[model samples]
Target chain A: MTSSHLVYLIALPLFSSAFLILMGRKADKWGHIFATLISAAVFGVGVSEFMAMHSRAGDMRAVTQHLFSWISVGTFQVDASLLLDQLSICFVLLISGVGTLIHIYSIAYMSHDKDRRRFFAYLNFFIAAMLLLVLGDSYLNLYVGWEGVGLASYLLIGFWNQKPTYATAAKKAFVANRVGDVGLSLAIMIAFAQFGSVTFDGVKAGVHGASPAALTALGAMLLLAAAGKSAQFPLQSWLGDAMAGPTPVSALIHAATMVTAGVYLITRSNFIFDGSSTARLLVVIVGGITLLFGALIGTAKDDIKKALAASTMSQIGYMILASGLGPVGYAIAIMHLLTHGFFKAGMFLGAGSVMHGMDDEVNMRRYGAIGKVMPITFATFGLGYLAIIGVPPFAGFYSKDKIIEIAFNAGGTKGIILGGATLLGAAITAFYMTRLMVMTFAGSKRWDDKAHPHESPVLMWLPMVVLAIGSVATGFLFNSGNSLVNWLAPVLNPNNVESGSELMKPIVVSSLALLAVILGVALAVTKYRTVPVEAPEDVSIFTKVARRDLLQDAFNETVLMRPGQILTAGLVKTDYFAIDGLVRLIGAVVSGTSTFLRRIQNGYVRSYALIMVIGALALIATIWVVTL
Target chain B: MDISNYLYLSAILFTIGAIGVVVRRNAIVVFMCVELMLNAANLAFVTFSRINGNLDGQVASFFTMVVAACEVVVGLAIIVTMYRSRRSASVDDASLLKR
Candidate 1:
């Protein structure tokens, strides 16, 4: 709660990264030690913060560490203060907790990488940036961390720069995010213009006094910024492209920490969003579309990591849904975030294990009947699938199921849409997951004889095994109606955990969702399992309509891509002509001057004297006119 | 005329020197042109000091003159070096790039 405690979270990693970089070429050996220690300690501090928050859940603890006055002008002041509250704690937990797992996993994942030291250093750097992002009390400070996370993501995504595709993917993620970041910067300008303040506390107060139209516009614009960062709907295409990065990074920035920043921003300004139903509805609608889209696309992908990425997109949809539910749903959304962090990290690591053994072959078709060879990996994979599918008694089931109930309780068209959309996504989730599980783990052997797929090293499996436990236990935390909700009763205060199950009639909802999950498993198993255990790499219908993401990529290529290329060419052409035109004009003037001046070199002394006389006469005439 | 008129006249002279530096092909002329712009700015600084009844402007001008003198000496030294090395002061012909 003191300044030192707040300072430690940031300074520990910041200094260690500096120390690691200073070690130069010997960075790998020393860098690993520094990164692992800092992340674990930060996670410890986060746990303490959560405990502290839990103790005082009813009151928002304004833990401020005022480093100095950041800005001071004519009636404009903002402190370089770090804030600790429910919001900061939630982010701190995500950054440090998921961060710790990624750090450990990297020790194995990047052990053979030549730039292992640099990898650890970048990981630490991202954590520090993410910390600053969450802990900053003011908009300007948050933006510093916001843009910093963007820089870290860009660097880490293309860690293997030898591949041009990796570099392009990194650039795509960076540039696309910049488009949304502009809205954030503009929104900050608007906030400053209308309210003359930028602190979280200040802006919240200002919103109360602001016009409804202004509030709605500001809220929607801010959510747009969040949507890009969090991979919601229109801005989500870059996320699929982000598979070019290391899998551990997908677990960290893409899944756990960085993408959730959008929700953090919106939820922090819960007061502002509550004022505008339109803004809230837009949130629900966008979230619903992304959830359904991501899961469907996820179902159609063969690259193991890309499938997880699409699933990441879908999971973030649930977070957006929770955020739109306001504060009551806020706790559930964050809990969902926490549980998703564990399971998603584990699933990615498990996929990494399978890839490691298969010599980087991630296509599930090459991996059939892997359950016998790698039992541990298979078990963790099964737990992850269950957690993700929201099977009863798992963390994903509780958190995801709660979101569906929240949607139904909100009532009206949106309620029905969210509730229905989430259920439908749940079915596809089960189907694709069942299809994937059977193809990868349940069916007969498929790999070549020389390729011996085995369990990952214990270093990797430890994290997966632990997270599998978390995914199973976490859902039950919320099972007794208000159990999970009551845990955070301190934050939302006196309001009893809205028995959402009661309101939405959880019995019917659960049975229906349960039935959907069952149906998905049944159909996928019936079609693929008994057919000689030979899941076709390309079923004609699956090939035409499903696998290439229903021709989204193809459609983008012909419909969006060709036109985009032409437009880019046209812009370049216009730019080229305009620039070349100016260059030629300047060149012509210079050459013309050179030509005109050549007469001076014609060896004509008498003519030169005659020109001097004419110049003198002209000057005298001008002077005489002025004198007159 | 007010002291500002002298400074204003110096400015016009400086501009003429600047154009000579640009228009001429001799290194010495360009070196002399830079001195002219510095002196013009210094003269304006002093004029404004008197107009405002302050001494800070004059003090700055004095320092500017000292720096400008040091710069001129350095500039000539470099030109001398170039001449010794290349045996030419015609700035256009001193294009070692072509060689």
Candidate 2:
């Protein structure tokens, strides 16, 4: 079905963003409210479209809207179009829905900020871009949205660019994302070369005729693009530093919507991954390595937001790993992504609320016993904590456990290794999250006497309450009746697992995950039951390394950044000496010749006449010699 | 007398006039040397007319004399203006165009 309403999903927020920014300080008082309403309106459109899709059946559920013919050449053609299928509807709702709530939350959160109007502008811009990312019909169309979000992310991350470090963090993110964009560009070129098309449907149809090598190359490049945007390993270093942005930016762009773009990309390219096991295995390996890599870093982080950043990385790793599992893993990865979006966004907002009450202090050690002072934040954050730890009746229990079960059921030594790694990740996630909760909420008060913690205003906690409710309900809602999977089946083309091919039963896997969670919580509770206000200077080497984000930045500097710096320096020297020097030499020769010839033009009339006579005589002499 | 002797006399007069123009510093002396060169050229034109048996060279000589009379008038006026402005008539003294 063709629906004209799809364009409004992106247009409203985009126009509002422009209006808010152009209006400047004059709209400061009501700009955030306007932005929030626009976001809510976009959500309203998304929900209405989703309902329209839901009322239909099977393949009829998806809708496309062609705005115009965007690119047309002799044989190449592309349309500026939108697709509101089951997959994209989920993202659209999450981006605009969570986005609206964040906008509301930011209304109160940034009331004191003089640049509140600009903040709303960036938020609206991001919502529009993220919507475009999901709703784009083809890889080329999606790349436009991809770059749009990267630009918005850079802008929002450096929203307070007066701080040099914050500016650096933003540059780091932009540069890293550019590296990944190169991968996306390469993937599109490969798609066009291999299939003569860049659209999802076209690529899917062409995958059968293409060679495995082509498919593998396309999949790997897509994974690189995903890793960069999704903050997967290697390219993952920028995300932690990205905490330098405001909390809402961290929650919205870093934690919830933007970071999951990788999982979305991989899932959208299911046919390519399904075509090549080598590409699929590489995905699993990156996902597995990052899951543990992030989880280990999470264990030692003292900053509340950085800890959440690490956890966000680890959770995205789960989604990436799930997407790698082929037909069985695709829909489950998205489900996990949706649920993680809610819980993680809620927790980040909760952290922001804590910061709001505590004078922007982020160290968890100074946050002991403040839960008593801030009840609503504590309750909302506690629910998110429960959801993330995969406790029963909460969101993560449903989504993350499914990923673990599927990892175990891949049915080989590979399955066992992946399964075990995910299990260990779950345990580590529980430990760190519990430690964060305990360090901030459960222990004796550690804040100084002057600090009087209080609950955030109603506007802030209202969104937290909404997301907390999502955290508690979305998992069960998505899991019951296998609804989410069935809804996405048409898009993902899920393959049914034969009965008894499973390595472990669902109940056994759930029980094992619960056991790991229990062990992790127990260890955290005992260790942090009585915490010191100051983090100990002397600690294990592992603790030290984890505290330093496992030296990912240092690793990047050595492997990528340092070498890049050297190459740049060499190029600069080459430009200065070779290119500039050549031009300078030419300039010097012309000026030297002019200077020597200029002296002959001394303004004496007698000398001028003497030269004219000599020249005339010389010319006559030459004519005479020629005649002879 | 051979018309070639008249050509030789014209060439010698032109060379001496050119030398005078180059060597003289006074503006009046330079102007007089320029007039002498013009007359020497007119003599050449008349000698060539006689030898070639055509009226073209003689007509050209008549035009040259007219042009020379105009040049003398303009040149004397410019030298008088320079002398009045600077209280000197040396061509070197009027070297304001020197680099």
Candidate 3:
């Protein structure tokens, strides 16, 4: 198949979403079915495209289809185009493939909602935007998709708008993303200013000639954008709150597609990051800090969706960190992103299944011994848990272990620090994920008398079962013999190959990672297997800090939001007392003069006649004086 | 009589009518005063026609009298409606337009 065939992958969902929206409530009866079929068809197109690309000759594997000239003015131009390249092909498959499963799952998950058609429409819209994001050939096109996804996410997150908090969460997510979008838009402007082009290939070609400072600025700005979209470091507070959206939204947009756009962007621009060591190190530092940041927060969250959201943050952190590792880490980042797409989407679906069974209660403390009640959810969630913790033979083991091994082999004191950070993150990840599983599914019943935990419908579990199998098998399939690495070699630099150290060999890194997982699991099982009645109030300061997301919210308020509020308040005062006061003064003068003059307009016809005669006499006298 | 004397007499009648219109509260008295001012203007026009040795001013007076008759028809209908609605013909009581 030619590159033109890639349009099907994007167009199917785009048209379906448009149709659903246009049809509105009239299509509510079968809108979800239409959405699911469209998503599945897109996945089918992605698979075909991937297969055709895989079968092509070297360098022929990449294809670009130019649709039209999007913008052109005096030596600057961009195209509305699509690219089916090695890097983007992976994103296409992950978005559409997992999107299909989530679409199916949402049919049952959102069955009771009166606006299920609208929900499916938003889901399809998200898929289309994500596809555009990955497939676009230029930064301008990517930004169009970027804002499109942001809009879709805002709509989905606030789908149940009757609740005020849900609306707040959606607004917060939108506002926070807009902050990062500024960074992206500025970076694109800089790209065009410096390189005279915003296309991926054009920018990549121009990076060699550009000054180091310009490249660093571009890279740093891109990192900011990524951090916002992927929920890294300072911008991450919105992701947990985003769980106020429907469970399917949390699964598809938050856990799977929308959040990983950051990694894809960074990796897509690997050439730039590969050029600037300072920028690359910044990416690594942000990722390293965020991984630990998310893991710490994950350990303290009691809400199931929030905890999972935290875990998603930490996982994306790992991918970002890997992308920052330079060219060697790009393939690893993409691999991890793909596998993460499978397992995380599965785990979130499992969480949704658990919520379905447990009357939509999200507090994990009130959950226990639900494994027997929801065997499929437990089984799928268990597999995903194993995959995430980097257990042997599972998906995360292959992908995440490669990243850990690369960090160790980075070869310096900085390398060791980053490596240790990655190792610590892995252990924390294992601990929290295990704690989640044990508290939720392993212990004695903690449910109240009114609770009736049972299995979700076949539609929900079927997707979970497919994803669970992928969670088990995808890592080994992608990583063994470096199949994904070789496939991505033409687009990404292949120089940063795995250079195992004598001290930190692959076996040694794998064993160490495994040991950390084992330790984390043992700690969680010992503490939470027989669940406690209530959390102890007098916990250590560190635990307290972690539980409150290390006061990240407070930090944001004091540092960012509070200052903004103060400035706004000052402006408002100025408007009220100064700007509006001027207007008020003019209005008062006019009204006061009118009030004095208004008595002359009293409805007495005789008074009006007298005034008219006196006015006529004065006019005649003035005319007589002037003539004289 | 001298035309100047007639003009002076007409001016005095018009002034009294104008004063009466300003001070009077009753609608009927205001209407009668307005008619007196119109008759004074008609007398001045007839005297001016005699002095100018032409009939233009007399014809104007005739047209004015026709217009006055039509005005009286419309004005009395409105006055009658006002009296029926408000139980009074005092112009002060017709100040609903003030609102």
User: Each prediction's Cα lDDT score?
Assistant: 0.79, 0.94, 0.91
Q: For residues A1-628, could you state the per-residue lDDT of candidate 3 as single tens digits?
A: 2467877777889999999999989999999999999999999988988888888886888888888898888888888999889988888988888999999999999999999999999899999999999999999999999999999999989999889999999999999899889989999999999999999989999998999999999999999999999999878888988999998889889988899999988999988998899999999998999999999999988888999999999999999999999888898999999999999999999999999988889988899999988998999999999999999899999999988989987778878998899999999999999999988888888888899999999999999999999999999999778899988988886564555454477898899999999999898888776766577779899989988888988999999989999999999999999999999999999999999999899998999989977997799899999999
Interface RMSD of each: 10.5, 1.3, 0.7
Write one digit per residue (lDDT tens) for candidate 2, span A1-628: 8999999999999999999999988998899999999999999998999888989988798899999999999789999999989999999999999999999999999999999999999999999999999999999999999999999999999999999999999999999999899999999999999999999999999998889999999999999999999999878999998999899999999999999999999999998998999999999999999999999999999999999999999999999999998898999999999999999999999999999999999999898998899999999999999999999989999999999999998878988999999999999999999999999988899998888899999999999999999999999999999999989998886465432278988999999999999999999999998988889989999999999999998898899878999999999999999999999999999999999999889888888899999999899999999999
Mark the regions of model 3 whose C-alpha exceeds 4 Å error after superposition.
Answer: A494-503, A583-628, B1-99
- TM-scores of all models? 0.80, 0.90, 0.82
Cα lDDT tens digits, model 1, A102-202, are: 78878888888888888888889899989998898888888888898988889989888799999998987897788778868877887888789998778
- Docking quality tier of model 2: medium
Candidate 2: TM-score, chain B only = 0.95
Q: Which candidate order results from sorting by TM-score in descending order?
A: 2, 3, 1
**What residue runs in model 2 are displaced by over 4 Å at the alpha carbon?**
A23-26, A494-501, A620-628, B1-14, B26-89
TM-score of chain A of 3: 0.93
Among all windows of ten consecutive residues in candidate 2 chain A, which has the lowest summed lDDT?
Answer: A493-502
TM-score of chain B in each prediction? 0.85, 0.95, 0.95
- In what order do the candidates fall by DockQ, top score first? 2, 3, 1
* Clashes per model (N, Cα, C within 3 A): 4, 1, 0
Best by lDDT: 2
